[model samples]
Target: MNTSLEKVLVNVVDQHGAVYTVDAMCERSNDEPNSFGDCIRCINIDDEIIKPSLDLHFHSNKTGKVFKLS
Candidate 1:
């Protein structure tokens, strides 16, 4: 239900093929609007964020549709 985060999906070819996603959030800094350097210092770097979304397809012999998986 939280729809504020942004995400990007990346698919790689491998034996145990899986899709990877990069997620991020955008927030405002608590400082004067003109202080660009000060805003960079206010960013939170101690959080671990994982986005829950997926899109996957299987590897095939001809066109990579070999298996049915979750």
Candidate 2:
């Protein structure tokens, strides 16, 4: 199986509806890495919900314009 690496911004919610977001780098083979689950288990982040950021962006030094991180 080939492994892939990706950078993602994940949003996590707690039981109390409190929201927390984290930027994570993940590596996966055959299946996507469970960043949200790992974040919940390893960190103190809440697991009420997990969603990928739709507007994830990065700036390029050459273009000087913001581009999606996909």
Candidate 3:
């Protein structure tokens, strides 16, 4: 798979239901073998680069399931 760094737009929703669109740097790979391709590196929020934690848990609204990020 070919890997490259890409700039992506990410939509973030706050606790107060405020949504913000931000730019993030991510490592992207071609989906030759599998579907998983992008890995987020850092998010640019208010001119600051913030590295997010990968150990967080996410709840899916459609599936109503909790998934852990590895």
Candidate 4:
């Protein structure tokens, strides 16, 4: 498959109805890397809830999980 490097953000909810966001950048180099800290990396982000306008960097500089946003 043709995999390209990308970054995405997701929403996270606490015990309450409150909302939180996170960034999940995915890249397929030698293997793949991604993040899932569920932390807000950008604001005013809204993309059909499919993709976030913002990006993620709360996780370590190097992650090893491939998170597909689509």
Off by over 4 Å in 3: 31-38, 56-70
Taken over the whole model, the C-alpha lDDT of each candidate is: 0.28, 0.40, 0.55, 0.36
Per-residue lDDT of 1-70 in model 1, one digit per residue for the tens?
Answer: 2223223223323345543332223323334243322112111112333222233323334443222222
TM-score for all predictions?
Answer: 0.16, 0.34, 0.58, 0.28
lDDT of 4 by residue, 30-53 (tens): 443333332223322233122223
- Highest TM-score: which candidate? 3
Can you write out model 3's per-residue Cα lDDT over 19-58, one digit (the tens) per residue? Answer: 6677767676675443222376665666656655554323
Model 4 TM-score (2 dp): 0.28
Query: How does model 4 fare in lDDT?
Result: 0.36
Give the higher-TM-score candidate: 3 or 4.
3
Show pairs that collide, candidate 4.
none
lDDT, residue 12, candidate 3: 55
**Cα lDDT for residue 11, candidate 4:** 55
- Candidate 2 C-alpha error for residue 5, in Å: 2.3
For lDDT, candidate 1 versus 3, the one ahead is: 3
In candidate 2, the residue pairs with backbone N, CA or C atoms under 3 Å apart (3 or more residues apart, or in different chains) clash, namely none
TM-score of 1: 0.16
Q: What is candidate 2's lDDT per residue for 21-41, written digit by digit as tens?
A: 655555555664454334221
What's every prediction's RMSD, in angstroms? 15.0, 13.0, 8.5, 11.2
